[model samples]
Target: MKNILIFGAGSIGNHMTYASIKLGHKVYITDKNFAALERMKKKIYPKRYGKWNKNINQISNSNLNKLNIFFDLIIIGTPPKTHIELLNKCKKMFKYDKILIEKPLCSYLENYNKLENEKNLFCGYNHSVSQSFQKFLYLIEKEKKQKKIFISIKWQESFKGILGAHFWLKDEYDTYLGDISKGGGAIHEHSHGLHLAIYILKKLKIKNFDFNSNIFFKDMENKPTYDVASVLRFSNSKINLVLETDLLEDNPQKKIIFFNSKTKIIWHNSFTKNLDCIDYQNKKFKKKYNFKKNRSSEFEKEIYHILNIKNQNQYNNSPLNIKYSIEVMKKISRTLKNAKHF
Candidate 1:
């Protein structure tokens, strides 16, 4: 069993802890909030899996505590703002072999540069590890060998809160959707799709592409956020991404379309466990893939794959991939400014 340290007890942190425990890994959870930690401990006990009960521990925020713990992996689920500080702290305490951090690695590019020399640091860009998306990548790669391609994604969702507004939640709330800086707008909300697209294109060795987005709204802070429609242009391909978020749709639907000289493939999801794919050509062919039902379990599998406890058919360089994402974010930032009237 691998020893893992999770440095946050928020929603994502709790999910990470639950997932790690389910995978037969020992997890130590630490958070500055004593009340949140207490609640997590209680919630964690009942959710423990069989013999894994003995492997979980909750560490409070006390400096008197010894700093000699050795962990195989460290998963940082804290807010984006705290990533740099947490990474610096981890670098000082333990020489961890692998670290998994959440998306947008840091709010600023300079913060991420601090760990440039560190090896085996994995950013938790969850879409990179998603089985459904991986399958989609496989299909796209296979098709790229034949003809030119074009893709479009139109995704819409309501009540955009961080981890709280997912379909599993029965109530609707609007805490995060409006906040531009904190929520990072629709671009960040829908960034996984863009990253997945870039990953597929990079794998196919397709270069010379153009991407831009148009923004819409801002929160009370006037942070100049967006509800955007981004367009991407490649030598032999073109893609249009439309995002209708928080303020618009009541029931969200995510649809992705791939078009080529001979065929058109569409993948869509709306309150479903599996995504639906349709191929339209001389005739119509329909297929579906199960996207792994549980979000927490999927994340755990990703962590295992990152730690090499589980084998994944991995390819491409993570740093380069993250750089591509950063570029995309930069473009979004510019686009948000350019489209201020909309």
Candidate 2:
């Protein structure tokens, strides 16, 4: 059992704490809002995660400056805007071999170069570790080359659902969800499609690429963060990639398609954990592949993998590691800059 310290007790933070404790590890969580910590304690600690013998403690942000404790791993689960600042704080206060930061890593690239090359640092791109996605990779390896790839994602869900699921999202306007500067948007939040596309290309050993995007923001009160349809295009000498993201769709959908001139493969994965794939050629061949439910399994497996890392070089080369995320973030930055806005 490892002693873990988690900064930020928001949605992702709470989940990480629960995962750590469920795996029989002690967790010390820190948050600026004491009320949020108390809510997590009541909501998570005693019902679904109570029976574990491991201890769970909440440390206020003010007290973090005074506490001196060594943790096996430190997870930065705050918003994208706060990651770098909190990370700098943890570096001073803790001695840890591994650090995991929640997705999007950081909101901006201004200070990205200042970050150290820490081999023990990993980002939470859990989709890269999903069994279904791995199987998709394995299946696609049989093809000599992919001529084109297309992905469409619709991440529409109710505000009430968000509030119910993540208690910290009660005040939608105050939370990071309503602020574009803090990495709020369909592209930033539902970025599994973007990362997975990059992951697939990297896994297939295709590197030369260029990205183009057309994005639009929702005209709402307070701040107008983009929630409407957006088109992201990626191209290289070998392939043409097209991906679309939308948070305003009435019926949500998530899918990916890989095709050459003659053959095409489609993977349908939305709310359902089923990875239903159909491979076909117009009149010659058609095949259907079905995978079982393995959503929660990815998080469990990712935790196991992070804890077992012993080499810095290995982490640097990991798909879910900071190096790749930095590269992906750079591409995203480019896409945003060149986006065609309405």
Candidate 3:
């Protein structure tokens, strides 16, 4: 059981804390917002596992100077703007081996470069860690061997305020969208798509591609942050990604549709949290593929994979995943600039 320290009390932070305690680990959570910390404490104490324990500590910019405890892992879960400051503080307080951060790693290219120089640090893009997405990739790989492919994603945001801001805000929203200086907009949010695209292209050895995005959100500082649509063109493939993040929409729909020249395929969440894949061939024969749900039972599996807890499958390269994430960020930066002008 590792001692983990989490630095934010947001939704992802809460989930990470829950997952860690469920694995029988000791967790220490600190948040500058006392109210958020209190709410988290109340929500967590009643649901904790028998072997698990947690301590909620209040921290602030001034009080942070006194914190000296060395934890097995330090998770930075704060917003994008706070990343660099927190990273610098962590570098001074703990060894590089102890840090793990969330998506878009550092908020800016300069900060990312600074963090890359640190030794023994492990930063990951958590979306790729999802069992559902991994299974999706596996299936895509199998399909690629058989025929040419095309992909389409319609990410409906009827529930716009929930997970939407957490992931998509950096990409489509105004406050962060076009502002490369501050890490705003779709590339930040939709970067997972970019990463997945690049991963598939590399695997399939596809060379040529084109990307286009239409931005409909402006004045993001005082308004809702969301995007209209973005499109991608690859060798023998074209992907249309529609993001409906407007606050005016009452009922939001989120779905991903993929098509080969011959058949249409739909991948979605199942009733049991597993992934459901349906294949339709010219409205004639339909087949369904239900992927086994490993995320729930295998929460520790990915962590163990990352930590090398046992003899696990080693990735072909040590930092390939991190490099892929950085590449996606670069693509996102380019996409954001184009979207801002349009």
Best by lDDT: 2
To one decimal, what is the Cα RMSD in angstroms of model 2 from the true structure? Answer: 3.3
Candidate 3 lDDT tens digits, 159-198: 2543353442343333444443554444454444555566
Model 1 segments beyond 4 Å from truth? 43-54, 63-65, 108-118, 160-178, 219-247, 269-271, 274-286, 309-321, 337-342
Q: Sorted by TM-score, highest first, which candidate order results?
A: 2, 1, 3
Over 164-265, each residue of candidate 1 has an lDDT whose tens digit, in order, gives 323333432233333445534556556655565666667777777555544555433534444533443334444333333333444566666777776666
Residues 1-342 of candidate 2 have per-residue lDDT tens digits of 788998887677767877787678888998888987877777644444454333778888778866677788888888887887877877877787788888887874446655557667888888676555666677666664645554333334434545555654545566776665677666666676777777777777777878778777776765646444567777877777777776665455666777766666666663363443444343487777666654345566678778878787667656678876776567567667776321
TM-score of every candidate: 0.78, 0.85, 0.70
- Give stretches of model 3 more than 4 Å off: 43-70, 96-98, 106-124, 145-147, 158-187, 220-229, 232-255, 261-265, 270-287, 291-305, 309-320, 340-342
**lDDT over C-alpha atoms for residue 96 of model 1:** 71
Candidate 3, 288: how far from true, in Å? 2.8
**Each prediction's Cα lDDT score?**
0.59, 0.69, 0.54
User: Candidate 2 regions off by >4 Å?
Assistant: 44-54, 65-67, 144-164, 167-171, 270-296, 340-342
Candidate 2 vs candidate 3: which has greater TM-score? 2
* Cα shift from native, residue 261, model 1 (Å): 2.7
